[model samples]
Target: MSLSEEPIAPTPTTQQDAPSGFEETESVNTSMQEFHQLYQKLLVITLVLTGIIFISVWIFYSLNTALNYLIGACTGVVYLKMLAKDVEQLGAEKNRLSKNRFALFVGLIVLATQWHDLHVLPIFLGFLTYKATLLVYTVQTAFISDS
Candidate 1:
């Protein structure tokens, strides 16, 4: 029979026999998984530091200020988490979304500052804790070995 007219037989394939494109996709998934794990680790560190700061503020400052700090820290964490998800889903649109997020964050800070009852300093520090945690984690990963 001519190649075009011949009936093709099905062939069984194993995982190792996957196409190059499939292999590349698998690697991408693995890297994304690693990134997610690192993100969670950073989040946990940020929360713990936030808790410590909240406790200190509660002891040294007024209850309203302490609550504001907690609120700010939680807001920052939620913002970062949402941003990460947005980046993953939007891919090419990340740059635009990032700029939008920065504008939103700055607007929130300005609003908080204008609210006379809310202590701006603690709120600003709490907002910064998320980035500080990420920086510390990145430095640790780059400079420290598991061994």
Candidate 2:
């Protein structure tokens, strides 16, 4: 039989039997969605924890302290969001965004430090709350697998 006379193979008619690259892209999209969902869950958890802490402090201490803590926690959340955006960028844009983030962080720290009425510890702790979300995500990904 000549090459031109050879029979052509049938193409996949279903998604499951599609090309490996297509499946891989689908998996990547699925994982991206999962990551986003997990990130949102973690963000909510962090906010709730911060709110609880703030309320407790407000009841025991003064309103000013509680407000400061709340402010710090909110700022931390904002910073985390900004950092995520920066991370999503590539090359020069990423570097620029990263530098801007760092500068903003430093400025906030300085401003908070200069504010004599605001307690440093609470503000600092509040700012670090976002790290808890990252830690939770790390632990989850380490233990959990898509398979």
List where candidate 1 sits over 4 angstroms from the true fold: 1-17, 90-97
Over 4 Å off, model 2: 1-9, 14-17, 87-99, 134-147
Candidate 2 worst ten-residue window by lDDT: 87-96
Candidate 1 per-residue C-alpha lDDT over 26-142 given as tens digits, one digit per residue, 9 for 90 to 100: 888998898789778988999988989899999998888898888788878977887777767665454545455677578768888788887777787778889888887888888
Q: Which ten residues in a row have the lowest lDDT in candidate 1?
A: 91-100
Candidate with top lDDT is: 1
Highest-TM-score candidate? 1
lDDT of 2 at 123: 81
lDDT by candidate, in order shown = 0.80, 0.78
TM-score of every model versus the real structure: 0.77, 0.72
On residues 1-147, what C-alpha lDDT tens digit does candidate 2 reach at each position?
Answer: 999999999899999879999998898779768767766887787887788888998999889988888877888888877776675564535455546766766776788889788777778777888887678667777888753
